[model samples]
Target: MTTKRCTMPFLRACAALAGVALIAGCASAPEGAAPKNSNGWVKDEVSDSYVFAYPLVLMDVSREAATGNAPGQAASNTLRNAQSLPPVGASSPPEPNLDTLVSTGWLDLGNEPVLISLPDTHGRYMDARALDMWTNVLWSTATPANERVNGLKAQTIAFVPAGWKGTLPARVKRIDVSTRYAWFIARIQTRGGADLNAVRRLQRGLRVAPLAAWDAHGKRAAQAEAQSGAGLSGDPVETGAPAARVAALDANGYFNRLALALEDNAPVPDDQHALKILGDIGVHPGDGAQLPSGSKDMAMVNAGLADGRTRVATPPSNLLAGNGWLWIGDDAGNYGPDYSLRAYAAWASPGLPTSRDEVRARVAQDSDGHALNGANRYVIHFSAKQLPPVRGFWSITAYTTDGALDGDAPVRIAFGDRNGARRNRDGSIDVHVSAERARGGSNWVPAPKGDFRLVLRMYAPKPQATDGSWQPAAVERQ
Candidate 1:
């Protein structure tokens, strides 16, 4: 197989956002640069920082608005799929049904609280939590448990299964305490004699409901993020200090500004800004009425989200500032699954030179229900001269389909330039990932029972590396 490798020094140079040289390397203004604009007045430290930060803030906000739908869920976007466990063999035992128990189902209690019901798959609903290909969580059991299923009487309730097909006590429902942004999937055991359809129905019925609408156009969002260059998805312009001050001001007062700026709907009134409505989120005078028999944690989260929505008609200034910063800063959190196989800690961004199609992709699954088949191996690839673009450190690791240490991993190791990984006569590094051991495998990491993933980590990276000017090479199967 043809594998493109990256070198260390090249990657190192890429770290500092050296790409700026590719644009224009004008030196910073000497100690006293000309005034920023028509105002001709020098900006104070805070104001200057904010002034330089405004375009970045706008960039960040626009990019965030884009994630409402992006390649994150696309089949060709393999970065996320790799993080989950692939299915086990056909004869593998039932691990978990992602569509059920852990689907993040949500139901509005309306202005008031509501009671929710779930079926027991086994005595235990969820045995272990496995991240799905979508980075969604799935719960599985080996044998079903049938203990006290007191779902209602308790303030916090959830079904904990012993194993697959374990029975649940006659009437047990988990009640969770209240909180905002709380997510829980109560596992329920299924009876042995029950038909497969019944179990399937249980799986189908489970889900997160009454949620925010899914963001529809991910590509468009990504495009916007790419142009800004500041946040995980934007362009960074060279504004002077005044811009930085604007960002600080936005942060200091407009925590909710981002929420507003990135709104899928029309612009909000400045006086009725998003921050004005966000200040009261998750705050309660106190729990006046106690939930005697219900899921306390679940209820708390539900109420908190609701309260934030109702009390705060606008958003918070701090959140707004954060949003602005994120938009232009070119920083975004990696939320989707990574298959734990990212050979390095480094991640792929939307704006890399490599086509999204060439990076990563996923398949249906393994018996374990995680994603193992990577349409492209080494989701992030670099060559001998193009090692990771980092300021500090870099390494690549292998992960089993379940995101656990691969029991079958060769030497159970990760490879990195710092670790003495032998280089080829041509000066390229070979990182082998598979179920079998590579002869003299210096960087062999174990693969779990099912599919696996790889990660490449770059600690303390330079701007170009994180900003997506330099892209990693792809992994080729031997």
Candidate 2:
């Protein structure tokens, strides 16, 4: 005879968890919150109720973070309300043709540790970045390390991270993640362009403000939280050790404030509503003066007050950092292999190209001492005396959509000076990319079917390579 126990925690956790499943059912949700629901519940649960809900809490933040505002949204109005902003860093010089990648939302896992697992691309290890766009990461300690999985469709990936200590899989670098409550932010790293020197030079322009000041601000906010005591799951829930809880909330709050602050680059107006809400407890979306007094703004206010759906219940994605491994774009692209999964921490990166003109349209690198990605019909010709300036070694490779190495992968994959890649009579080297690499004979590297990416790695690069003096030829479709 078994007795069924009735419990409030159990019920709330179940409802909250079920809600999250609907949002980002893929990754792990708050520890115990899910009965099934996922994504949607997180943002709301956190925003409306501050109580700790498993997995959903993480899911909410990630969804919010990934759903970024359109660029230049609210530019005019924000400019009118603003004091000052950091100067725009030097924009890249116009390339023959530039492909711009706007910032998009990242996958969020609130408060749960997630592990991404993908095999080392048939052990090729190169070209992990291209696969990142279609990889799945698991949000559970139950999973293993530095691994990615597949759902047979290859669209969903199961990320396996063995422990909580690392950043991301050594093979996969960056992926956007945030909590509904998050305010802090992390951007994707830039690509390694042809001019290694210019890449390094461009990298120089980036800077970050200190966290100490942020800590002070967070402290103040936390103190305020203690006095007011917000609820969790829409019901008033008192925080234990109010001071500690407040500080934690403040840290998360500060991140919320930060995201709102950055809303106006080429700023569009559509995304402004969310940005305005960076607030004491929830996202406000109200700049007050700028909001139209006409019917629209009034309707907006009414919507927020009346429709529970209009309010953000989840914390921002940035807070999801602790729940699972978080990485940047460069890491995702495999520019720095094991950047997150491995013990990689540089004040900056070394893989950035030296010049803008010498950018590779796509590239890939692997831990198996190989580099791969889409060179589809496009070959980065390395003019001999100008071999890619990699200090450690180099290789060209190709992989499938989910970062798997394919036997029939197109192109000529080669790496290390040891391979008998024929140096032209003039000493110039040419890397030929084609769906049919075997036809090119010894120099060919095979590619998979469908869209692809590539990377050219030069470990221990030279002064010219790192200083913007040299540049790799861009990936050109033959």
Off by over 4 Å in 1: 1-381, 407-410
The parts of candidate 2 lying over 4 Å away from their true place are: 1-277, 280-378, 400-404, 407-418, 476-478
lDDT of 1 by residue, 155-177 (tens): 11232321223322234333222
Give the alpha carbon lDDT tens digit for every residue of 1-478 in model 2.
1112214345334434433332222244445543333333333333322221111222233233223344312110011011111111211111101111111112223333222222222211111121111111212111221221211111112222122243432333233332212111111112223422332222222111111111322221222211111111110111112212222333234234333433311112332322323232233332222322345434533333232222222222211021111112212122211211111111111111222111222343322324333434545456765676643345554434433344343222333343557666787776666555445465554455555434344432334443333545545455
Q: lDDT for model 2, please.
A: 0.28
Tell me the deviation in Å of residue 235 in model 2. 43
lDDT for position 17 in model 1: 32
For candidate 1, give the lDDT. 0.29
Cα lDDT for residue 121, candidate 1: 39
Best-fitting candidate, scored by lDDT? 1
